[model samples]
Target: MSSRAPWIVFGSALAGYLAVGITLSLRFGFILGDALSRTAAAQAVLLSRDPHVSAIGFIFTPLTGLAQLPMVAFASWWPAITRWNISGITVSAAFMAGAVVMVHGICRDRGLPGRYRILITVVFAINPMIVFYGANGMSEAGFLFLLCWAVRRLIRWVGTDDVHDLLLAGIALGLAFLARYEGVVPIALAAVLVAVVTACRRGREHWKDMRRRAVLDAVLISGPGTAMFLVWITTSWLITGEALAQLSSSYGNTAILTQSGGASGDLVQTTAFSLGAFIALGPTLLVTFPLAVVLATRRRDLEFVVAPLLFGGVLAFQAGSYITGSTFGFLRFFICAIPLAAVVVVQLFPAAGDLPTRRAGAYRRHRPSCPPMRTAAAVAAAVLCVSALPVTAWAMLQPSLSSQQYALGYLLAGDPSAADSEATTARRVIDSFATERELAAYLDGQALPDGSILVDSVYGFAVLAASEYPRRFVIPSDLDFTQILNDPAAAGVRYLLTVPNEGRGVSDAINRRYPTIYDNGAQLYPLELEVPNTGADQPDWRLYRVPS
Candidate 1:
């Protein structure tokens, strides 16, 4: 393999990602709600006086926002960068490029030929879900990058038994945890695998020495990540005054899981839904995954099998989340498994002829006959390759079938007027936000007294996007809206912008507590004064003046 091959692959993938990021930003304008929220949080971190209070809590981890601070600060100085959220999108794309590079490195480390390495990198870079998220302001890309690096480091550690490698792996996993909560699974899995593998190798030659090393490896792999998780939880508690603020809140995943339906039927339905979504996103994985497992087993290659184990672990975690109803149905959740799947596929065919025959005494004693196993493995690989070829070709042809497309289709499915084209859906999304943009413009024009406006969660992004003084508006999404309304003066709320679609409980309570001063399908009730609407969308926004 040429020394420049990985860099060539990385540079090409980065260029492609940047182009896609720019195009998607211009066309869709950051369509995902989560992306918008993360953008808003990044802005809060950089621009707000009180970031801990102003930024949305629990649902978001802070690393992505913190990472965006430099770009957000730059954008503040140069407003043109804010046009397409170039800063955020660029950061995501860069991380995605890093992920592709990591994939190439992992393949190379596993002794895959340069051609196969390039093929895996190309396949991963062009994956629709990966491309879509890579072009947006989301954490998935960043998390995947960290995850790939961590896995690579662990693989290196296992092969070389270098404590430094294990420590680096732990640090990467810790950072990954900060990027996304699901990172804990990798940390835990790595720790257990290290302990198990080390213990299995123990013998009289160095019994105590091997046991000590095994214990050290386990601790090194898990310690930093676990400590990071606890620190984040502690910080959340101190800031929000809830020890488990990230988990206990009504908006948190734990609450969602608790409220979700419980039954064996729900489990089965969710599992099927998750698998179906995975297939839709990456159909080639279905063949590649099992084929890799068969090949690895035939060769008795412990390191090769780790790829499948890691991929399976991620899938199982997602399946468990779905069954428990802790997560919403989304294709992005399955993304972590994509690179591993690519590794599996690329190695499956090439490794067949490179099978290692050496085995331990225990394994040699119980090993199955070689000829039949080899023949079956060969046949399976052939079948998988043939089946996967058409699917892979189809995937390459339809590189634009992304999670955003699926989400937009689902949203528009109920609207009889929505056209089937991507342009139409993108336009509809922009049009839907027209009210928000207008409301934001109106609020900016008002130049209302500081700490005067209180906003519901639904309009948080709109307010942030459109307002000059976004931090001035109080968001009651994580708090009790009724309490804020009981003494509006005490809370320094002079006006309220109510969007009935969000937080029905809060909307209902506010409507009951105060008389309606403005009702346009979405009602705006005044606690003290009657403030008339000033040319905003009637059905989408209602503005009311609160009596001091």
Candidate 2:
């Protein structure tokens, strides 16, 4: 086992993936502090029975947070791994590590060169999408690992025409499908390619061979695959009386749209911008995909690598439906596939014809010689690594810098007597607690007994802040704050909070909607006076009395 020689490939992959994973996580992981999206995902889970959300009911709802129960369980029991940002960050990294080992083993079995295997593994490790998404709680990282493993297995089977490999490939694809619905596109593409190759080889004679082998592979893989999917479906059905209804509801919800024409335009803009962003990430990928097309024509060398690229493309296409302007997130969706494309590009460089060559399977084989510039290779690696520095640094710093700039804007425009007594209230608001403490403390001082408080934040805060008063602070399903202001029931709100920096237009609108009752200037607002309800620039809230 030690002499099998793929461990070097595994080690190199682990080291590179870990380095990129840690670097990205050091910044992206902690920015929200304890402000996890628990409400989004958890609410989906809780309301799994709601018809609108039922389409997604079978699957663990991501609207709450990134990690699934299985993922959380694994992280919790794993020694030296805490179930927080850093630990959760390792989930995708660990999956990539396993994928690298699997791919290395498969390549070694195919008698690919050790050096080549190491090189491709490194390429996979540094793949931008892989590094970015794998460290995130998002499902894309796990899906990529499963999809890549399946593709490698499928290709290995096609190259060798081994039933064991074929069956394993099916199982891997099946698992990939369970991980992400988009995985089916890649699996179908792979199956079609394999079937076509088998048919052309011996005509009718090959037909039977292909059918029998494919059937056996499908049966073997489908056993576990079907079971995994059924579990989610059955649970969703039991909970919501329909399989995937939560997902369907979540997918179909478009109530946020202000106008149909505007929404349609937004969708078009999203698709165009997403495509532009993907192209910008690497114009080389558009070129590289054609190489995949050319390579796919080689029946014996049929790498299922194209499957993932196709699947990613399919997912990218779906980004058009996202009305919330989340198209930028699609870049991370295609990140892992970029490195694979780079590796295939590297493989296309023809081996020097006149160089010293060792016949395949020679023990301690002669290194394929003739490239005299070892320094050039080292320089190339250094250049690629350093080239990413500017981007990595920019991505890490942009959020923090933008937040600081935003705080400054608020500070300058904010009124001292209305918001807070001090002029520096804006900075204090920015520097204050990263958790629910600030909002909770402000509510506690109001002494209003058991009624909803409206705030523009994710629902998790609403739940946590109101834990002492169950169902007191419900997230208004109808987000018409204008209507809430006029309604007598809402006019008596005990505590009104605004995350002026985080919400869309709520920051500017808040100041415009309410008169300043009392302001310390920056944050401490105590309502001691009333003024006309004219929509002019004012403090965040103007409390109107409810006549008894």
Q: State every prediction's TM-score relative to the real structure.
A: 0.78, 0.57
In candidate 1, how many clashes are counted? 2
lDDT of each: 0.62, 0.43
Model 2 RMSD vs true structure:
10.6
List, residue by residue over 202-246, the lDDT tens digit for candidate 2. Answer: 556657656765454445544555665666667666765667643
The 10-residue segment with the lowest total lDDT in model 2: 356-365
What are the candidates' C-alpha RMSDs? 6.8, 10.6
Query: Per-residue alpha-carbon lDDT of model 1 for 200-303, expressed as tens digits?
Result: 56455665666876787799888999999888888777766775654676555565444343233476667776776566555656777666677668766566
- In model 1, residue pairs whose N, Cα or C atoms come closer than 3 Å (at least 3 residues apart or on different chains), thus clashing, are 528-547, 529-547
